[model samples]
Target: MKYLEWRINGFLEAVNFCRFFDLGYNGNRFTWERCRNTQNWVLERLNRALATRDWQNNFPNAKVFPVESASSDHAGIFLTLGVNVICYAAKPFWFENFWMKEIDIKQAVQTTWEHGKGQPIAEMIKSCVAYLLEWGKNKKQQFKAKLKQAKAQMTRYRNSSNPYHLQSFNSAKEAHLQALEQQNIYWKQRAKQHG
Candidate 1:
């Protein structure tokens, strides 16, 4: 009991210091689990993720979920940063400003350029454009799928009656909100490019 009290005090102090709240999560509830058959098992939430009020405002849909640990004693955490994935009409080719900041961008561009060398100028441009388009399409699809999954999970939490699920509902909602925000940013940037 003394140890438990000490832990509780420490937790309260940490929470106060950070000015953050727990991000609701779905999936495994406990981060730490140890068991040997049905005779004995211990479970505890040893690990957690917290977000500030500012972070909550910025990403209302952010969530942190525990994934299967497999061989490990502790579960892995999955954080959703909130991005809305939608099926949009095909967009025109345009370079993304963020791509310039990627360390591999130079290498990827150089590789594409090398592959297109010795071809006619128009054909070379076409090759590079095709490569870039394919790359972008794949990346977008991956992001879209992840966002969709997070949204679906949030919906599930909303429909449930379990107290734990209800508690997590807010966190899930926040993650969804974050995804919407991401969509807003994506369109805003695209609009800026056209403007």
Candidate 2:
């Protein structure tokens, strides 16, 4: 029980820190690999708590979602950090289906491989790698471009002295976020890849 409380507290602190301070342990091994060996300790602690089913009322804001386990004895976890109750929104799966392409995606992958003619093995591999790289880059750019536009529109509110206009921009941003949330399936498909 004490351990669960500790885990919940750690989870809340980690999210709050990221939302405001951008400093906290991220248990993602890849992230740790890039910098100092900083583990996502906070997340790890929360996962441990769930495994024990030791939860209490000490945490009002912390959310714990059950995970579906295909083989493991314990379910996995879905954590929401830096979420705002005032703005309250459904959590999102960072991965999207749009990323998933049916065998049709093989068109992109195969086209890249098939074009490997006079090129050496290494060169052929590089060409295919470049194709996949550019595909990912294009997807990132598309979303970034849209987010940039929204930020620019919000900036216009700073120039206005009227409180009404300021509130208008705030609402506009909320609406923009909602639009993005509704399109989660679009992202899921974009992210899905059978190829």
Candidate 3:
């Protein structure tokens, strides 16, 4: 109970620090439950939607309610902005910054652009985009295959007692880490573009 209180206090402090107010919910009061139909069953209002004053003013009629789910222990919160939602069409082309790190990208682009000579600027752009998209797709597939193989090797060598196996495991582990770091950078660049 003391630990729970401490956590609650910390949450409250954070909320206050952010100047966020809870958007009161409707429907089932408890958002989570466990040990259903047993003596140890517990229910808790663990989930909530919060917003700042500016947001509240912008969408004064926003509403939040809990939706019970049969497949999960926690209820999903549904929020309505109480206004018409505008759906924007996705952009046709997005150049990933992470692609710049690839050694072949510059050469690939140069070759593609060279082939686009004597065409309109727009046509050249379209051709370059098509080539880049295909190139990016191939790179992504290769990375995934490399990562999978590294993971398999790491697992195979994980429990071996031989020093050679240990060295192989370490090499596989390093390859796996490098692949993951590259993937992380790719996603981070993508998130920045979208966000």
* Model 1 residue 168 CA deviation in Å: 29
Q: List the candidate numbers ranked by lDDT, top first.
A: 3, 1, 2
Tens digits of lDDT, candidate 1, 1-195: 699999999989989898978887776577776762244667788777888989889988887887542246676788997879896888768865544433566777788999999999998888888887777666556545645766677657844667788667767656555554445455667889779
Q: What is the lDDT of residue 147 in candidate 3?
A: 74
- Across residues 54-106, which tens digit of lDDT does each residue of candidate 2 receive? 22233434554433222332334545544465746764323334445223456
User: Local distance difference test, per candidate?
Assistant: 0.70, 0.50, 0.81
Evaluated at residue 80, the lDDT of candidate 1 is 90
The best candidate in terms of TM-score: 3
Superposed model 1: Cα runs more than 4 Å off: 1-11, 84-195
Best by lDDT: 3
For each of the candidates, the C-alpha root-mean-square deviation to the true structure, in angstroms, is: 12.7, 17.7, 13.0
Poorest 10 consecutive residues by lDDT, candidate 3: 66-75
- Name the runs in model 3 displaced over 4 angstroms: 1-91
